[model samples]
Target: MFRWAIIFAVIALVVSLFGFGGVAGMSKDFAVILLVVAVILAIVGFISRGKV
Candidate 1:
């Protein structure tokens, strides 16, 4: 999931450089969402590991 976020971020950067405003915006949004989810999942995993 974190890798996916990084991929989307790279895509957003490339598209922005090429002046693809809409695509860049969408990709950036996806990256942010994925990154948030990844962080949440990581925290959950850490907590669960502690309990175990």
Candidate 2:
């Protein structure tokens, strides 16, 4: 999930550089969403790991 976020982020950068504004915006949004989800899941996993 995190890896995908990075991939999309890079893609967004590349697309933006090439002046594909719409594609860049969409990819950036997806990357941010993926990153947020990944962080939330990681936090949940960490918190649950110490369960009795």
Please tell me which predicted candidate would have the highest TM-score against the true structure: 1
Badly placed stretches (over 4 Å) of model 1 are: none
What pairs collide in candidate 1?
Answer: none
Clashing pairs in 2: none
Put down candidate 1 lDDT per residue, 1-52, tens digits, no spaces: 9999999999999999999999999999999999999999999999999998
lDDT per model, in order? 1.00, 0.98
TM agreement with the true structure for every prediction: 0.98, 0.97
What lDDT score goes with residue 47 in model 2? 88
